[model samples]
Target: MVNWNSLRDELEQAKQEGRYRPLTVWESRSGTWMTLNGRRLLQMSSNNYLGLTDHPDLKEAAIRAIEQYGVGSGSVRTITGTLDIHDRLEQELAQFKGTEAALVFQSGFTTNQGVLSSILGPDDVVISDELNHASIIDGIRLTKAHRKIFAHKDMDQLEAVLKESAGFKKRVVVTDGVFSMDGDIAPLPNIVELAEKYDAFVYVDDAHASGVLGKNGKGSTDHFGLHGRVHIQVGTLSKAVGAVGGYVACGQVLKDYLIHKARPFLFSTSQTPAVAATCLAAIQVLKQSDELIKKLWANASYFRSKVQELGFDTGGSETPIVPVIVGDPAKTMRFSDLLLEEGIFAQGIVYPTVAMDKGRVRFIVTAGHTQEDLDFALNALERAGKQLGLLG
Candidate 1:
């Protein structure tokens, strides 16, 4: 029999270090407010930036898709799984992203893994931002390419690395469009400029920025007006799109190459028809108006300012994702638990996800939250902060 003692010991150590994560059960669809433990809590930890998960249009689209296509795409894209709706969704996504073509994947994680592993080889070099998402890091590890890391958003260090890696067969600079933990945007213009100068490929994972940035949320490339300059753009349909799956927007040649070579796309089943329909509807919804995006930003601004006024440290946030940094891991977890008791649901992020010295409770403000709801959460936070001596 396999030894279980080592796994048990690791679990015990995680618990002792305040890094043990428990699954949270929700009784309702995730929105600005959700049911947790039979209690209604203000959900400030969701990635539903535009609150489109429960939208009537999305629901109607999903229902229509189910009637026409039923559930599940029976096989992988290489075989019999590529539905007409899948093609339509890819066209819609490509148009929205202003790319020659787009290819949908199982998830944001797999998109990174498939794209990176398929494209890079032994003679290639990948320069990544230190704070890029875990998925990107894992994707890089799957490749045989030489890897280098630069300090988070440190353009000078990025340039230095680019200079050093000039002799590689292919040099790619990969970074997250928005840093999830710190809620800061990548310097895309600088990155693009440097990449152009150094003859490197610019790859941006715009997962968090997809529905929260740019003109009607066209993503970081459009947000920074660097359209067509960046080589690859990867984004998720789950976060702000209020659905599921991921996509990589690139030139037609690259899309064709990934279709033939990416293992995940070759082996895994395509997204469900309902999910494809939902994502298409989301893009249409975004094209129609910018009202939800505006409201989301407004809510984020209000919450961040108010929380900072309560003597909480919101570190370097420039978007709806706000992190209240508490240095000690145990105290950070305690603060999250206290907030939950006070009818708020913000998740505490600890070591491995973040540095041990930078444990924080991350809050994601959405368009669905009213001023009154935000005020209520703020009051609860104040009470919890005082109870835990986190405030003066």
Candidate 2:
């Protein structure tokens, strides 16, 4: 038998470094408030941007799908699992994104992994933003393409890299629509311009921006009014859509190529009927109105301003995903614990998720949060910040 003692040592070291995260168990649905350890805590760490998780239409749709199609998709999409609902979801996604075609994947991470690995070749080159998500990093790693990194949203460096990589047969530029940790929007317009000048294609992972930005939540491309300029757009159904799965919106040819060449799509089972239905309902909900998006922005602005007034360091935050930067990992975790004691549940993010000195407590305000909820959490944050000497 293989010895597992080394694993325990590694875990112990992680714990000592304050980076060992234990799973949090919640006894209730993911809403503005959730039950944890028999106590109600204001949930500020969820990515339910539009609060569609608890929407009546989504819930009803999910139930109807379960009744009609059962609980699971029994096979991979390329096999027997391509249900009518899945096709409908893809069609809806393509229409929503204004793309010629779209392909679904198991998760946002896998979507990146499969699409990048499949599309990029050894002779090609991929230029990535330094602060891009781990999924993007892993996807680029899986590709045999020559990789180049530019500073986060640095247009000059991107242009420089593109100029330097002009010799490659093909060049692709990839970036996250919204930097998850800092909550800063990517300079996509500049990127698009640069890609055009360099004869490179653009790929944007819009996981955080999918249902949180643009007109009627059409994502970053729509927000920036660069619809057809971007070559590839990947987004998650799990975040603002309040469902599970991921997709790549691109031209029909690329979609067809990925369908055959993307290993994850071929190997993994399709999303359940209920998930597809829920996603469809979410799209409908977004299309019908922007009430939830407006409400979310209002709450986020209110909460972020209050936190900043309390002297918390919110690093480059331009959206609902706000981070209270704390330099020490241990102190960041302590700050999270302090907030929890006061009935809030903002999660502490440490190294690996962020840089060592950039540890923070991340708060994701949602549309479901009332003014009262915002005030209550702000009070809790103030108290916690004072206790930790994080506020004046």
Candidate 3:
């Protein structure tokens, strides 16, 4: 009756093909350097870009919130969900993003899903980036919108798509402000101009850029000097902020629409009170201090420079997420394993995460990583590359 054996066969094939992504348990802290499998290693794998995940302010705020409001929010925001902390965090995010309103979601993925699905329907057109995050792809799939994906950051292709979007009920140009894997910026000024020319709405998922780009990590909109023009700016507290939630900053009317129409936002339980408070604290740090963000950029620059000098192609990366494009999944895995043994935790990214033959060893640098830490990781990577026949 059940095809359990067939499913098992599929898994076996994937494992044999070197596509298995086994989770490795780490016995350590959420800091720049960590312990994995009983070995202390440099952690260059997390999305904690601004190093705020373990900040005293955020931790203390979460602790205070737990003490006062207990652990969970107990219900969906539509019911008894919106706690006091949620309201405060929303306010802070709205202010930070220069938006009239903002709404929080359970995670960045859900946030993207909510925004795309709620605003677009059949007959609507969604012009998306070819390499936008998987969550955005799924969100577009959920909508009834006709989707057209242009080449990554190729404004010409985007404009061509917009030119051809004349028959839809509405058109929305969606993109990731910072390409998560490529670490390059979206050609926003061109995209924004094209949207205006085509009378289309603009949406940006700033998951990777929220606390890495722009002044004090205000995000890509601010980075590009186009503050209020973008209709939706979706961000996650899970990345640079190091908390656990998502939000969409937009006009009051748009936020109102999502509150009523977005199923994920309406049905999902509120973020834990502790999470909301920690997010607020993280935003406060971003708003008031640039020290950590500065450190993050410094670390990124140093690491990128070293990687390039080592003759590893980083693939147009302009941020902390660096990709060592290793072509074959097996080679990528071998490179990762070699680095793992040498105490660097950069992982191999292959297949579904990226297209076939584009497998890479994706490295992430953090604000907390010291020069010494970066040097250690670089040395390990050099040896790994040599051992894997990837370099001199």
Across 76-156, the per-residue lDDT of candidate 2 in tens digits comes to 998899999999999999999999999999999999999999999999999999999999999999999999999988899
Residue 303 shift from truth in candidate 3, angstroms: 0.7
Q: What TM-score would each prediction reach against the true structure? A: 0.99, 0.99, 0.98
Q: Candidate 2: misplaced stretches above 4 Å?
A: none
Name the lDDT value of residue 368 in candidate 1: 96
Judge candidate 2 at residue 304 and give its lDDT: 90
Q: How close to the true structure is residue 261 of candidate 1, measured as C-alpha lDDT?
A: 94
lDDT of 3 by residue, 182-278 (tens): 8888889999999999999999999999999999999999999998799899999899999888899999999999999999999989999999999
What is the C-alpha lDDT profile of model 1 across 1-392, one tens digit per residue?
98999999999999998889879989999788889768899999999899999999999999999999998889999899999999999999999999999999999999999999999999999999999999999999999999999999999999999999989999999999999999999999999999999999999999999999999999999999999899999999999999989999999999999999999899999999999999999999999999999999999999999999999999999899999999899999999999988899999999989998999999888999999999998999899989999898
Regions of candidate 3 where Cα sits further than 4 Å from its true position: none
Deviation (Å) of 389 in candidate 1: 1.8
- Say which prediction, candidate 2 or candidate 3, comes out ahead on lDDT: 2
Total backbone collisions, model 3: 0
TM-score, candidate 1, is: 0.99
